[model samples]
Each structure stands twice: as structure tokens, then as C-alpha cells.
Target chain A: MERILEQIPRFFSGPNMTLLLEAAGLTLAMTLTGCLIGFGLAFVLVYLRQTPGMWALPLRWICITYVEVFRRIPFIVVIYLVLFFIQAVTPDASLFTIAVIAICLYAVAYTADIIRGGIESVPITQVEAAQSMNLSRLQTNIRIILPQAWPVIVPPAIAFAVSFIKDTALVSQVGVFELTFRGKELNNQGYSGLLVFGTIALCYFLLSFPLSMLGQYLEKRLATPRGERRSRKIRHS
Target chain B: MQHLEVSDVRAKYGTLEVLKGISFSIKKGEIASLVGPSGSGKSTVLRALMGLTPITGGTVMIGNERMNYSSAKEVRAARDRMAIVFQQYNLFQNMTVMQNLTLAPLKIKKWGKTDVITEAHRLLGLVGLSDRANAFPDQLSGGQQQRVALARALALKPQILLLDEVTSALDPELVNEVLDAVRKLANEGMTMIIVSHEMAFVREVADKVIFMDEGHIIEVGKPADIFDNSQTNRARDFFSKILRH
Candidate 1:
């Protein structure tokens, strides 16, 4: 136990500390890029899924297939699949780039599913009222539907973002040096596994604690009556 | 010419027919009230007229413009000349009452901000809700919300107004205020079709009262002829059951 306690100080001050810091930066970069690109692609897929008329039928099917395949398969399997394909197509692609691409592809499916739920959560009467006013379909969607769905959409979206940040650990499997990968390396280097892993867990907590707290804060803020009025007042003003 | 006309309008929810061969017409400045028990398709008639429910069969002409229910553009065109106020008031909860009134006019008609606000204030005053203009729907009583909804519908300057039991969802004490607003609108010669359980109000205000049963209009006549001297046994039976309460 004393050796483990002593290792904590060395763990923070040694070469492994530099490796951990670099990996932490990479982890953050992966998470942010993955969430942004993934959400953008997911929004497009959701739009295609809901687009009217026969011309969108094939596109909708493709979107459905994509969401189903990504959401149903394990994330690690998706990481492997993305890694295998990228390596086959371009053997010299950077490992970090491959990891970001893999995380993004995995996140897209869940984001779309959550957004669809948010849209459905809006009441049918809101649409009916918009239509009654002769607001065109597109007008109603943008002005009425989206505004009402936004409060409901945001918290879930932030929740997904926090999870995606944690899910960046999956990238370490493809050998992108991130927090977990660095911790594994340090453990192999003679430090106690408990101290090494405990430090890594602390790093992850440092990153994710704020995000989870943000999600909870937003949930309360958006759910309040005053929040509803304040948001609408801002929009109108 | 009739302000609104429907003939042989057929609508269904899935395989269950809600409106079967329903036909009615309201003159340019008349109030027609549809009254019946629940599930009699009174509300469905209003929904079908506004294109909220798909018209499975038949024709609707709004001010001589034949509506093609299957075409979204044509349906929207017809709706522009008409607006329906729902029983639930269905106010946009995320908007202030003033914004609710102005959103449609500003968005659909491309009206300027100043004109929309002026018109919104006028409508709010008309509904006796000028003080509540800045308030959200959730902040108002049910009656006030329904009145604001009525004013919001009128802000569009529609030639025909459809009211689907607008006062039915309000507290009993609050119903009279909404009815009074409707009565004032009627006095102003707004062409309207109302579906209500306020039988006394219907008898007093409706130029023509149409009694519906199941999926058909059982009787259509002048209020006195229908209420004081209903010809159909079903109509008399309905009146007796309700008037008893």
C-alpha cells in the first residue's frame, strides 16, 4: 500500500505524466470532432427519413439501414470495422484520424434516434394549429415545431455528448494513445495497476464530471416554468 | 354565393367512417351551429372542412374556390380563407399571446411588423384580452385562452371561421365570456360554423342549427323550428336528454 501511495506522486511527475497529458488532449479532440460531425450527419439522416413523397423513399431506406446497423452493433465492433476498412483503403491513414472517424460513425446513429424522439415529443396539436393558420409545412416545421421541440431536444443532446466523450475510450483499442491507453502502458512499466488506473479514472472524471453536471443543470433550467417563458421572451425580443 | 359549402363530404378514421355524406352550407354572413352527442362527427365535420382530416370523398368550396383535398397547395389555399378554433384552444404555448396572433400573419402573408402588431392589438382588444397580450397561454384561464385563440384566428382576416366546441373545454363560469366574444363576432357579421353543447347559446345565436347523429345530419332548420319544434324523434330525444340536465 505504501508503494502504491508513493507511486501516485511519481505517476504525476514522470515521463508517463507527459504521455497521459498528450493522450488526454487527443481524447478531447476525438470527442469534440466526433460529436460535431456525428450530430451533423445524424440531422441529415433524420431529415431524409422524414422527407415526404416517393423520391425520398430509397433515401429513407438507406438512412434506416444505416441507423439500424450502427445502433444495433456493439461500439467496439464498429470501431474494428471502421479500422479494418480504412486500413484496407489507405494503409497510411493517421491513427488519430481513423479513431475520430470511427467514433463519429458510431455516435451518428444514437444522435439521430434521440433527435427523432425529441421531435415526436412535441404535441400533434401544435402542428394542427400551425396548419390551421395556413402556415406552410416548412414554415410550421421551422417556426413552431422546432422551437417547441428545442427545450426537449437540448438536454438529451448534451447527455449524448457526455456519453460520447466517455466513449472516446473505445478509440484506444485502435491504438490511438488516449487516457486509458496511457494508463495501460504505465501499469506495464512497474507502477501498481491500482495507482495507474486510479489516476486514469481521475482524469476521466475530470473531463466528464463537468459534462454530466451541465446536462443536469440544463435539464432543470429547461424544465422550469420560468425557463420556458424566458426562452420564448428572448426569441420574440 | 355561400361563404362556405360542403356536399357529400366523407371522412374516416382508419376504416371507421366519422363523417358520411355530410352536406351543409353557410351564407356569407350567417352562423351555423352543429350540435349533437359525442362521437356524432360534429367536430370531424369542422376538421374535414379545414383539411385537418382528409376528405375521403366529396367537395368543399370556399367562396367559389373548389378545394382539391388531395393537393396540399389547394388545401392550404382554401384554408387561407378559413380558420378553425379548436375545443382545446391549442395556443402555441411557447409564444406570448401577442406573438401567437402575429406569427401567422407575419409568416404567411408577409405582413410588416408594425401592421401585424397593430392588428394583434385590435384583435386582443376585441376579445377583451388587451391586458393579457404579453402573457403566455399557460398564464391565462381556460376561457381567456379560448378567447385569445378566437382573436388569433380572426387576426388572419379569414372570411369563414370554424369553431369546434370552443367553449366546451372551459370552466362553467368561464364559458360565458368565450360565448360572449363569439356572440359579438356573430353580431359583426363574421361568417361562422360552430359546434357546441351550449344548447341555449346555439338556439339564441345560430341562424341555422344542424343536429347530427352517428355520421349524418339528422335535421337542419331555423333555431326556433329545431329547438322549439324538432321534427325528428332523435332530435327531440337528444334535446330532452340534455335540457333535462
Candidate 2:
């Protein structure tokens, strides 16, 4: 305890603080870039998976197998596999790119289920109503189905992304200079392990807490239908 | 002239056949009511016409054109000329009553915005829901929602309107309000096929009543002949039991 207290000042020195701050930024960048991209790709994957007819049966099976395989694999194993595979394919690829790719691959698997559940939660009758109106399938999804599905989709998707901020610590295993990696480096440089890791933990909390608050805000905002929300605003005024 | 002709239309849900070679025809501006026991394929007939259920065999002719369900373009062309109202009053839950009425007209049909909005207000007035234009579907009673659904269907200006037990999900007291709206549409010469259990309304407004049993049309005639004087034993027994209440 005394050693931790003594090293705290040195651990938070200007150069050390800059390094930690950069690492925290990298961690945030990795999660946001990976998750945002993954979230988009998950929608495409789910849309393709729901393609109607016998010809699309193989496509559906492929999507299902991808989600099942990645979700069952350990996150560290995914990181190492991505790292080795990317290195073999392009030996000059940056570790940052590899880390982002791994995070994106994992996020797509988890969030595809989230997206599919959100879409399926909408009543089938709504789709029939749209279809009977001569709306194309793509038009039905964009104009009718997705608008109604956002409330169901957004909360869990945001929760997944926020939780992913912590899970990104796995990327440090592949030598990416994120928060956990910076903490290890600081600890190795004679700073107390408790002090370095403790600060690192605070940085992660700082990153995720505001994100969770944003998530709650979006959930509440989306949960109410637009007309009701407008009337609610009128009543409040 | 025959405005719509469905000849030996067949459909199946998996291996079980729901519609087995059903045939019907209606003239322009006529109202045809499909009356039957539950699970008798009355709704399935309307659904098959709307392409909501794939037609396993047979053909539908709208005017002189044969509606080929196997072709996406022709199916869409058939859908463009018709609209269907569901029993559950499946309004788009995220949108307001006015938005629900105008979405297809303004988006799918690409009508002018002001014209679509005007037609929407007119149809809302027709359904007596003009005052609730801004209300979301969940805020309204089932009757009001069904009326809005009727108005939404009308907003499309469909030549043929299909009502699949539109009031089945409503309370008894609320049934007449929806029926009254349909009555008004009938008076306006809008061609319609209504799948209904409301015998009195069917007798009053329907130009023809077709009785169905176990996926087959047991009888088709004027409302008086079918209700008061059914031919088939199945139709007679079904009507006596239902009409006695």
C-alpha cells in the first residue's frame, strides 16, 4: 500500500500521463470504429440472411454459421487468429489495423443476433400490410419495418458497444498500444502494479460511463413513438 | 363486365392446403361478402389475391389482364390495384393516423404531397377519424384503429378493396362503427370483398353472399337466398347455428 501511494505521483507524471491518454484514445477509437462498422455490416448480414426462396438457403446457412462460430470462440483466440492470419497475408499490416479487424469480426457476430431479434420482434402483419401496398421488400424494410424496429434495436446494441470497451482489453494481448498495454509497460518501468492498473481501470470507466448514459438517453428517446413524443412535448410545455 | 375473376385459385400452407380450387367473380362497383365458419379459407382467398400467400395453382384476372403471381412485376401490378384491411387493424405503430394514411400514396404511388395529404384528410373524414389525425394507433380504441386502417386502405385508391374480418378483433359495441364505415364505402360504389361473420351487415350491404366450408364454396347467391334459404347441408347448419345467436 505504501509503495503504491509513493509511486502514484511518478506514475502520473507528464510524459506518463500523455502516454496513458494516447492509449485511452486509441482504445476508444478501436472500439468505436470497430463497433460502428460492425453494427452496419451486421444489418447487411441480417438482411442477406433473410433473403427469401430456396436459392438463398445457402446464403442463410453461411450467415448463421459465421455468427455461431465466432460467438463460440474465445476473444483472445480470435485476436491471435486475426493477428497471425493478417500477418501472413500482409506482413506489413499495422497492429492497430489487425486489432480493429478482430474487434469488428467479433462485434458483427454478436450484434447480428441483436439486429435479427430486433427485426423479428416487429409483428409480421406490418410487413404484410406494407407488401400489400405495393412497397418493394427493400422499401418495406427501410420505410416501414426499420422505423418501427429502432426502439427494440438501439438499447441492446448500445449496451453491447459499451461492454465492448472493456472487452477491447483483449486486443492488448497482440501488442496493440491500448490502455492495458500501456499499464503493463508502466508497471514494467518500476511503477507499482496497483497504481498503474488502478489508473488504467479509471480510464476505462471514464470512457464507458458517458457512453452508457448516451445509450440510456437514446433508448428513452426511441422507445416512444414519434407522434406520442410530440404530444408529450406539447403537454410538458 | 367482370372487374375481377379468380378461377380455381389454389394455395397451401406447407403441405396442408388452405385454398383448394376456389372460384369467384365480381362486377365493377359490387360488394361480395365471404361468410363462413372459422378456418374455412375466407381470409385465405383475400390473402391469395393480395399475393400475401403464394398461389400454388390457378390464376387471377383483373379486368382483361391475367395476374401472374409467379412474376414479381405482375404481382406488384396486381397489388397496386388492390388493398387489404386485416382483422387486427395492423396500422404502422410508429406512425400517426395521418402518416399511416398518406405513406403509400406519397411514397409508393409518388403522388404530389399536398394532394396525398388532402386525400388522406378526406379519407379520415370518411371514416369519422378526422379529429384523431395526429394520434398514434395505440392511443386509439380498436374501432378507431380499424377505421383508420379502412381509411389507410382507401387512401391508396385501390380498384378492389379486401377486408379480412376487419371487425373480428373489436368489441361487440365497437363492431357497428366499423360496419357503418364499410356501409358508407359500399354506397360509394367501391368494389370490395369482405370476409365477415356479421350476418346482418352482410345481408344488408352485400350484393352477393358466398358461403364457404372447409376450403370450398358451398353456396353463392344473393344474401337472402344464402342466409334465409341455404342449399347445402353444411351451409344451412352453419348459418342456423350462427344466425340463431
Candidate 3:
């Protein structure tokens, strides 16, 4: 306990802070790329859902298979799969590039699932209303439907981003110089272990706390009153 | 020429059949009201005509062209000639009332902004929502949303309008204002097919009143015959139960 306490001053005074920033940057890059990839796939899959039982059955199975396999295999395994199998084909790929690619592939699977739920969450009548206006299927998707689904989709997306920031620390094992990697190296170089990890944690909190708060703020702001949006906001309390 | 004709139509959703062998004809400039209890296939008839629900067997001929389900392009061409208003008012909540009203004409017609905005304001004025033109759907009452819904349907300049109980979802107090707005549109000789339970509006405004049961339209007649003096037992009972109060 004394050792842990003594490390605090050493942590703030050392070079560990810069490493955490690098980790946070890699995480954001992974999450955004993953989100964009997943969102694009989800857009395509939603149209496949409009087909009849036989045509949709196989397509749905493929999507569910992709999501379930990647989600359950563990992120560590996903990185290794990209490293060993993909590296065999594309030798000399940098660790940073590989980490970003693996995290994006993993994140895309989950984000696609999230977007699928968001698309389904929109009421059927809303889509029909777009059709009633003579908008085509694609037009209806971009113009009428996506606009309504966006507010509902935002809160969860931000929540995912915050957690994803922490998850990027795992990429350090693949030899990327992220925040966690830097903290560990600093501690190994004779900095106090407790102080190093503690400072690392503070940096993480600094990175994620505002994002977490922003998610909550957005959840409150985007929430529409079912009975009386015009008269009063729906009270969360 | 008859403006619209429905001959022996069968429409289905999933495995359940709705609008089973329903047939009707509407003259130009007529307001036809379909009245039925819930789940009685009244809404399905309008959906069938709009080609939202696929027809298993039948023909919907408007003017000389058949509602051809033979190809996607054919169905799309038929859809271009009509507009729809719903009970939920299904406004684009993200857009202001003016944006909602103008989107159809601007997007579907490729009309210039100045032309569409001026026409959109004219339609909003017709529905008495000129003042709330900039408000979102969330900023308006149920009545106001339905009024904007009317203005939106009008902006497309469609020859036929399908209204699926446009007032049923509103608060009771708000229902009258929307009905009055619809009544004015009906008076202007718009070819309209209304699915509604507002018997008073039907009796006074509808050229024809149709009573549907299960999946078929059981009876249809002049407003006096269908409402005050219904000829069929299904029609008579529906009128008695819905209008009892």
C-alpha cells in the first residue's frame, strides 16, 4: 500500500502521459472506421430484408453468421487472425496498420448489428409514408427514414465509442505504441508501478469522461416526448 | 370516363388475406369513404390501390391504364399519379412543416425551389397552417400535424388521394379540426378515397360510403343509404355500434 501511494508523484512527473494519448488516438481511428464500414453494410442488408422468405433466409444467415463469429471469437483472436493469416499474404505490413485493420473489422461486425437494430426500430408506417410520397426505396431510405432513425441511433453510437477507446489498449500487444504500451514501458523503466498505472487510468478518464457525459447529454437531448413534445419534454427523473 | 375502377381484387399480407375479391368504381371528382371496424380490411383496400400491398388477383384501372403489376417500372408509374395521408400524419419529424410539405414536389417533380416553396405555402394556407410553416412536427398539436399532412399530400398535385382514417389517431378534440380541413379539400373536387369512422363527416361529405367486414366490402351506397338507411345487416350493425353515441 505504501509503495502504491508513493508512485503517484512519480507517475505525474514521468513520461507516461504521451503514451496514453497515442493509445486514445488509435482507438478513435479504429472505432470510426469500423462504424463507417458497419454502417455501409447495414444499409445494404436492410434492403435484403424486404425480399421473401427463401431469398432472405440465406442472406440473413450470412449476416448473422458474420456478426456471431467475430463477436464471439474474442478481440485478441481477431488480431492474431489478421496477423498470422493476413500477414502471410501481405508481409511487411506495419503493426499500426494491422492493428487498425483488425480493430475496424471487429468493430464493423458489431456496428453493423447495431445499425440493423436501428433500421428495424423505425416504424413500418414511416417507411410506407415515404412510399406514399412517391419516393423510391433508396430515396425513402436516405431522405425520410434515416432522418428519423438518426436521433435514436446517436446515443448508443457514442456509448460504443467510449468503451471502444479503452478497448484499443489491447492493440498494444500487437506492438503498437499506444497509451497502455507506453505506461507499461515507463513502469518497467523503474517508474513506480502504481503511479504509472494510476496516471494511465487518469489519462483514460480524461479521454472518455467527456464522451460518456456527451452520450448522456445526447440521450436527454434527442429524446422526444411521446405525448407532448410541443407542450413539455418527457421528464427522465 | 370513370376516374377509378377496382375489379375483383385479392390482396394479402404475409399469410393472411385482406381485401378479398373487393370491387368498386369511382367517378371523377368524387369523395368515397370506406367505413369499417378495426381489422375489417378497410385500410387494406387503400393499400391495395396504392400498390403498397401486392394484388394476388384483380385489376385496378385508373382512366384507361391498368394498375399493371407486371413490372416494377409499371407499378412505379402508377404510383406517381397518387398521394396518401395516414392516421398517424407520418410527417418527417426532422423537417419543418414547410420542408415536409415541399419535399415531395421538389424531389419527385424536380421543381425549382421558388416555385415549390410558393406552392407549398399556398397549400399550407389552404390547411390553415401558414403560421406554423417553420415548426417541426414535434412542435405542433395532433390536429396541426394532420393539417400539414393534408398540405403535403396536396403539394404533389396528385390526381388521386388515398386517406387511411386520417383523423382516427388524433385526440378527440383535435379530430374535428382535421376533419374540417379534409372536408374543405373534398369540397374542392379532389378525387379522394377516405377510410374513416367519423360517420357524421361521411354522411355529410362522402358521395359514396362503403362498409367492409372481414376481408370484403359487404355493402356500399350513397351516404344516405349507407349511413341512415343501410341496406345490409353488416352495414346496419356497424352503423348502429359506431354511431350509437
What is the alpha-carbon lDDT of model 2 when measured against the actual structure? 0.92
Q: Candidate 3 residues A1-237, lDDT tens each? A: 787677667565535455566666766666566556655665666556444466578887876777788888878888888888768988988887787677777766766666667777788887887876678888887887777787777788678767777887787787777778887888888777767777778878888899899899988877855335544532443
TM-score of the B chain in model 3?
0.96
User: In candidate 2 chain B, where is summed lDDT lowest over 10 consecutive residues?
Assistant: B68-77
Candidate 2 local lDDT, B35-145, one digit each (tens) = 999999999999999999999998899999999799889889999999999999999987889989999998889999999998889998999988999888988999999
lDDT of 1 by residue, A16-54 (tens): 778888888888888888888998888777877988789
DockQ, per model, reads 0.67, 0.69, 0.46
Best-fitting candidate, scored by TM-score: 2
Q: What is the full ranking by DockQ, best candidate first?
A: 2, 1, 3
Candidate 1 error regions (>4 Å): A1-9, A14-18, A52-59, A86-94, A185-192, A226-237
| Best candidate, lDDT | 2
**What is the CA-based DockQ of model 1?**
0.67
Task: Report how far residue B203 has shifted in candidate 1, in Å.
Answer: 1.6
Worst ten-residue run, lDDT, model 2 chain A? A222-231
Segments in model 2 whose C-alpha atoms lie over 4 Å from true places: A88-92, A213-230
lDDT string for model 1 (B1-245, tens) is 78778999999999999999999898999999999989999999989888898989999887778896888887888788889999999999878899899998898888899988998998899889999888888888999999999999998998889999998788899999999999999999989999999989998889999999999999999988988789999999998889876
User: lDDT by residue for model 3 over B1-245, one digit each (tens)?
Assistant: 89999999998888898778998999999989988889999898888777788889988898998885656676776778888898899888767898888887888878899999999988888888889887878778999999999889889888899899898888999988898888888889999999988889888889998888999888889988877788888888988888899
lDDT of 3 at B160: 91
